[model samples]
Target: MTLEQLQTLNSIVLHGSLKSAAEALHKTQPALSMAIKKLEAEYGFEILDRTGYRLGLTAPGKAFYQKAQELLLNAEQLHSLGQHLASGNEALVRLAYDAVCPHNLIFNVLKKCQYEYPQTELHVFGESRFGALELLQKAEIDLAISPWWPTFHGVGDFQALKIGTFEILLVAAPQLFNGQAVTNIDQLKSEVNLVSEESELRFDSENLMLIKGACKWKTRDMQTLKQMLLSGLGWGYIPRHLAEQELKEGRLVPLTPQGLDFSIQGELCLVRREESTLGPVASMIWQSFVPPL
Candidate 1:
């Protein structure tokens, strides 16, 4: 009927006797017995079989005790969550990572945060070009992992830590070129360029390593763009790591446009708004990416 009574019954079951349960709970044997008696009377069932040398649960009591144990576990978790909130920990933290950034870098820190603050909920989103930054600027996310671009410098007052580097390579399915080496932009003009469209519409015109004057097809994310390239639907730039196996297997081949670098490397950064305040869990995640002093 009550948590205290339920706890008393649990102690008796664990210790196998009222006297032992009383000693474990720092209470008198009669007091422990009174708690159980009240519980059984309220529920109209005998909770324990005292005729045995050691106390055992009655058939009905087994089901009742099982339910009580589940309630006790939930209560403990609720108490812990209340304490976590009281300590200035946020109940939820939002994180957005650019599709171009490797998940391993961000997950390394998130895994630690999850272990330390099990009560805080993590909302993770994978965004296309500039998507993470847009979310951060809109105050929709607490943190973002994205490739750094000069365009970002004028976008917001952001604090960025260079976490790693990402490379985008121009590639196409070998079948698109029919085993012929592509040496000029003119050759690509006849084929569709599979471009991953910018996440933010304002930046839709921005193109990275796009071949000029080529017929274009657009996708919302790089993964689809890579799939399109793999199917010989078009040629486009994609994260090298995303297609490493395909490139090596000769399913996709790298392209070198004349007078232009087909491969581009950029800094992958952990970004947060300079003026926003982060709660305990978010701060812990941010610090996890910092190098040792």
Candidate 2:
């Protein structure tokens, strides 16, 4: 019935568990459970179905959560607008980015916004794209800056926005390539190590495009993979942003071996709660700063 109760219900649905929703809210499990219980009483419906360790939303729960998302967004927009108008200051904006995205474009854009909208406050968080979705569903983030996972289509909470596209590069420390740019799959296997990014997460497909090369390591963490490549440990396919500095500095070498081409396709994406209203300050950034995507 209340915003907080609706939020609790939505968070459970988003995160699929009380423990995670509690963690996102920085509340204890017991507190979250009680909040949900309170909502169940007020609504006279069962919102969650326990599945061993997972929580599934009932039909009504799913529909209710969608409305809650809109309501929360609207409430935040109203609050942000009033606060900004009263003080004539920039309003607080919280956002999230995909951790796999090393471009740091969001930082640059925010910096530009700082100069343009001096009264606006921007707070940012870094999370994997999947984690970012959780933040989006909880209405914890004002905007999401990351790559689009098409599977995300039809998620009712977001108004998805396309930004721009970037490239992924096959790279490694110079030593791995022995100072020669790789051109063929056989050469890549013979000359260096291959680090495959476990991309099964966003794709949801068992079949992956494994670059034909010598396998050195496999990691799900982009940071760990970057560090490993930086240490001159092995070669891997890395996001262009992460390898930009290294490539510029000649610390990392680009290898165009066979099957090396990889990209996220199309453009970067943004998702915000469709129902939320934005203050003038937040609206300016959202409308003006997307940069022709």
Candidate 3:
């Protein structure tokens, strides 16, 4: 019914207790209960599952909660639009990008944003794997670009467009492989595999890490992985573009073990929450990303 009642219901669900929700909203338990009863009466459907030991949402209540969340987000966006219009300058655009995304591409887009939207503030967060997407879901960032995709079923109203693909090269110092082919998983697993730290955070059933080697080394950044590979400490996947010079100079050798796919490929995607429309500045930046030739 009213925004106040909707927020009250949301709080109750969020806090999972009438008393906790009351404390959070600075209201009493009786008032919170009254609000829920009013909503249920108006909708003619149960919103909260009072049968549970602790208050929980019923089937209909779950659906209603989703709709309420969407409505709340839209309302917040409307308010932000009004503020931007009144000031003639948007407040800020929070952006998070995966480290594996090409630096040149990102910097080029940033330059275009700075030139076109001088008044808008850009707060950039550099993350890896699903980190950027996690921030996007929390509404902490307005836009995201990462190689990571959502779970197989996907999240609510999240849209991702293919921006470009980066080659995931399996390379190592010649000493590690000794110029011998690494065809079997066992041989590959025997050597230390340098991989991104973000790989550990993935829990999706579909999005499994490329290297399942028993002996593994983790680095927070790609540069560190490259350095370790050059030092013959470990062998793992790195962006082909970053290792192009090394590959050409014979400093690193690609491993193509028989019956195994060594060259891992991935796409960079521009991801955003479809529930909220992009502001003018964010829109401009979003359109600047084109599929790399």
Number of the top candidate by TM-score? 1
Clashes by residue pair, model 3: 182-257
TM-score of candidate 2 on Cα atoms, chains taken together: 0.53
What is the Cα-based lDDT of residue 78 in candidate 2? 80
**Backbone clash count for every predicted candidate, in the order shown:** 0, 4, 1
The residue ranges of model 2 lying beyond 4 angstroms of the native Cα positions read 1-91, 99-104, 112-121, 128-134, 149-151, 155-157, 180-224, 260-265, 290-293
* Candidate 3 structure quality by residue, lDDT tens digits, 63-170: 999999999888877776677667656668889988667778788888888887665779998775567777887788999887754461255467787888777777
Candidate order by lDDT, decreasing, is 1, 3, 2
Q: Which candidate has the highest lDDT of all?
A: 1
| Model 1 TM | 0.92
Of the two candidates 2 and 3, the one with more favorable lDDT, higher being better, is 3
lDDT of 1 by residue, 1-293 (tens): 88899899999999999999999999999999998999888989899999999999999999999999999999999999999999999999999998878768788788898899999999999887778888998889999988897677677899998888999888899899898999988889899988877666364464655667888888877788888899999888888888989999999999987887898889999899999998999899888888888
Off by over 4 Å in 1: 201-208
Which has the higher TM-score value, candidate number 1 or candidate number 2?
Answer: 1
Ranked by TM-score, top first = 1, 3, 2
Residue-level error in angstroms, candidate 2, position 276: 3.6
